[model samples]
Target: MRSAPRSMSEEVIPLVEESAVVGKREVVTGRVRVRTVTDTIEELAQADVQHETVEVTRVPVGRVVETAPEIRTEGDVTIVPVLEEVLVVEKRLVLKQELHIRRRVEQEAVEVPITLRKQRAIVERTDPEDPAPEGPPT
Candidate 1:
């Protein structure tokens, strides 16, 4: 088919695409509550404790020596010698007395009262619309 020729003056048209602005905001979905609980229990504990006792005794030994004897310990018994100087024709060292110390150990049963405490935390969740949720929120 044949078409007619257009006029010298013609109108112009412009094309455009739609656009929008997107933003984000925070929202409270649920609330969390926490509480602590304390508990106490009684129990018995056993242990072995050691203690030592000493018994001192004085023994008389009158003897003459050139010098004083050194303190010695035999087994659990300790021997401490005492000396004195006598005035005669010349000075002489004499043994006055001796002290014997013995040590003994004894064991017995004892009981004591004690208190112990334990604590635990409990959590509860609540929503704005619903009081309790069946499962965790996605």
Candidate 2:
């Protein structure tokens, strides 16, 4: 079977507007006034030959649509570090330091022989010692 172009109908239908989008099979059946040709035999032709009709149909063209993946810029992501604060408090010590009064009750120097004067003694002590013990004692 051979297909005929529908646009060829445009060549015959000069009355249709040029910019009109043709729709699906629109049929218009209207009556047209016509004068009959008559001769000697008068009782012949029918009065109303009203079967004139037109059908309009339209075909849509194919279209294409595309969806792509969403893209994000590097600036969209952000990183932040958490920070904490520390506070220091100072303490004052209230101490009463009692200096020792070395009562210089020098045991009357038993007139020691100059030979024994060069003697030395060793002693063990504990408390972290304070400096400069002075003055006459009780």
Candidate 3:
């Protein structure tokens, strides 16, 4: 430290100079987006399904009957006889007709169309400062 002059006539003047300093830091220049996309796909598939069907047939009974017959079923055939009484000089019963029921089962192969969904992820990074991923370490 130095003292100032006692008189105003005796005074000292000092010279000074200025300069600039530079530094670096990390800044957010761009952004990265990640999202998922869903897609639908169609394909052919196979499955087993069951269906039922019935068949009926008529038979003639041209004979005399005494009483009504009960419903009878066979392996795949059922017989049901219809009876009626005829009024004449001689009161008697007769067989009107009969019904035949036939049932059969069969299997078949069929193709079916099915729908499926698939998902995929997409990542996009846009930054002019860093173009390549392996260019620098994060």
Candidate 4:
């Protein structure tokens, strides 16, 4: 015959949504409050980088080489076009351009609700409230 002491009041819920980049993310953490964000956006940029030049040629081939230079006299003919005279090289490239004008400042972080009014004294209830744990969620 004991049933009269049920009065609990605690309500605090604020959870924002919308967060992209699923599989991988380097870094992301946000909370902001700057007078509800006014209006100011300025950005200046310039980029034109170009430098590339190339011209290369090389050929060398002559094997089964048996030489006896006396104008090849007696036995063994003469057909010399050994092939070795083709070379041209030129390559130059440079790139360095930097321009800047960036002024951006934004800040906001405000989430406050802390109430631990008091209720923590049940050293051991001997485990008997588990209709699939109908507990801990207020």
Candidate 5:
């Protein structure tokens, strides 16, 4: 029997395939951590504080005056006169009483306990690759 020749369109062709590979990995670059710490320190501070107190005393006074006396101060003692008008058929003025205002200043050495605070930064570095620790992160 005679064999027939194949047509151009019927001819078979072999082909090779090429492809790209995709992948992912995890890398430990570094780490950062924050922490808070507290510390105490001693310091000295000076300030002026005022304290007020009152003292009273009485004495006998038997006198009569025409007009009110003027306010005066001697040393740290202040003298103030209280007056009233003695009324008769005619209008009149008379010294009634006196009031004294006194002021005293005293200072005592005192030791005060106070609390102070301060902030400081401390950093440490570590690497998985290195067996020893690095001194600081920076």
Candidate 6:
């Protein structure tokens, strides 16, 4: 029974741990107010519109055509061919006057009267010691 062997700063023992450092700050929790309202409406609209009119007629063809007569569309009637170069017994290509064009389309029924405008947004929630609300939050 003999015990004696312990020396290196007495077998070292020195320790301590305890820490707390937490920080954050920003607080102003309540302020929002907005307002805008406008509305107007009146409407009456209808449409069916088409108009085209052209009528020209002059027909007198004294007959004699060997060449130069090509402008024809017959149904809506459009025939334009008028040419005359005649010296009797040598040069003849005469069929003077023919210009008949007719086109007519008319349909009319129209009425229009319109005025419209609309806008709406209104929200209110204010409390930051309540004394800052009179005008300017939109």
Measured by lDDT, the strongest candidate is: 6
For candidate 6, write residues 1-138 as lDDT tens digits: 897886656566778978899998987788878788888889877899999999989999889889988999899999999898989679989899899998999999999998888999888888977777777765
User: Alpha-carbon error at 118 in model 1, in Å?
Assistant: 0.8
Could you arrange the candidates by lDDT from highest to lowest? 6, 1, 3, 5, 4, 2
List TM-scores for all candidates, in order. Answer: 0.72, 0.12, 0.55, 0.15, 0.53, 0.38
Q: Mind giving the per-residue lDDT tens digits that candidate 3 earns over 1-138? A: 899867657667877978788999987788676768889999988877677777888898867867777899877789988887899899777877888888766677789899999998887888856654654232
Weakest lDDT window of 10 consecutive positions for candidate 1: 129-138
Tens-digit per-residue lDDT, 1-138, candidate 5 = 987986667666879989999998997676554445567888766666667765544433435676667988777777777766666897766665666667666665555778798766765555656554457333
Per-residue error at 57 for model 1, in Å? 1.3
Clash pairs for candidate 1 = none
For model 2, state the Cα shift of residue 83 in Å.
Answer: 38
lDDT measured at residue 8 in model 3 versus the true structure, 0 to 100: 58
Estimate the Cα RMSD of every predicted model relative to the unseen true structure.
7.1, 70.2, 11.8, 33.4, 9.4, 11.6
Query: What is the RMSD of candidate 5?
Result: 9.4
What is the overall TM-score of model 3 with all chains considered together?
A: 0.55
User: Per-residue lDDT tens digits of candidate 2, residues 17-79?
Assistant: 667686788543432223333333223333432333333223232222132212222242222
At residue 16, candidate 1 shows an lDDT of 97
C-alpha-based local distance difference test score of model 1: 0.84
TM-score of 2: 0.12
Best candidate per TM-score, number?
A: 1
* Residue 82 lDDT in candidate 3: 83
- When 2 and 5 are scored with lDDT, the better candidate is 5
In candidate 3, list every pair of residues with a backbone clash. none
